[model samples]
Target: MKPILTATVVAALVAIALPAVAQNASQIARVRGGASCAGCNLFQASLSGLEARGLNLSGARLRQADLSLTVMNRTRFSNADLRDVEAYGGVFSSSNFSGANLTNASFVGAYLQGARFSGATLTGVNFSGASLQRATGLTQSRLNQACGDEATQLPVGLSIPRC
Candidate 1:
């Protein structure tokens, strides 16, 4: 190929890659200094080790995000879309996930003590070996699939399963 043609192809590829790079820069910027990204669509974004504790991320679309090993304690994720998210080993203690869609999210061995999942859809979520102490509005089905203790709270007339 001629030098000009090679340069043109490289320039085209760089043009295509520039927008993605800029978008990633913005994502990093927004996560700093207790940023709150409400109503933003962050589906399938990897937010590992971002120190996003206590941020108000309500109504954000975090579907299939890799938030593993992140310190997101006390973050508000009410009504957020978190379907198929990989949050294994993440510390989500005291976080509010009320009405969030968490279908098929993997929370294996996660530290979710006192997290609220009231009215949240937890269908097929893996909470195996997770510590859900003092979690409010926890359904029996959710607890049955995960590891919890007697201190875990449940809805009215819901019996603890043989988990």
Candidate 2:
């Protein structure tokens, strides 16, 4: 009886963990297959070096994900949670990130030409050497909440605090 009870508990724990694992796998599959996975649970996903253009991942959770060197041009990441993501050298030209939470994300040397950031939270985001010269919807107030290095390029009359 004790062995049976132990087995039941183990099975229950496995059942609880499987859903999260399966959900992550399914979300990764959908994104890799060029499907728009809105509001998907992609926490801590490793999607480095992928060149998926024009993806719609609005309201998705991409916290702690590895998006290094990815070319996600024109992707829609509006309202997405991108906290602590490592996106060094990623090309996100013309992507929409309005209302997204990008707290503490690293975008070092990223190309963000014409990206939109209306109402997005950029607290503690590392934009070292990132290009935002053509980005839109950024104001002094929004830039005040974020930090960047001297090499970080921004639109004229807009400056970012040094990280």
Best by TM-score: 2
Clashing pairs in 1: none
Worst 10-residue stretch by lDDT in candidate 1? 19-28
lDDT of each candidate versus the true structure: 0.75, 0.91
Estimate, for each residue in 1-163, the C-alpha lDDT of model 2 and write its tens digit: 3445588889998898774542387898788777889999888888899899999999999989999999999999999999999999999999999999999999999999999999999888898999999999888998887888989999999999998
Clashing pairs in 2: none
TM-score between candidate 1 and the true structure: 0.71
Rate residue 129 of model 1 by lDDT: 61
The TM-score of predicted model 2 comes to 0.85
Candidate 1 per-residue lDDT over residues 17-110, each given as its tens digit: 7744212335535865558888766767778766777888899888878888888999999999998899878889899999999888888778
User: Which residue segments of model 2 deviate by more than 4 Å?
Assistant: 1-23
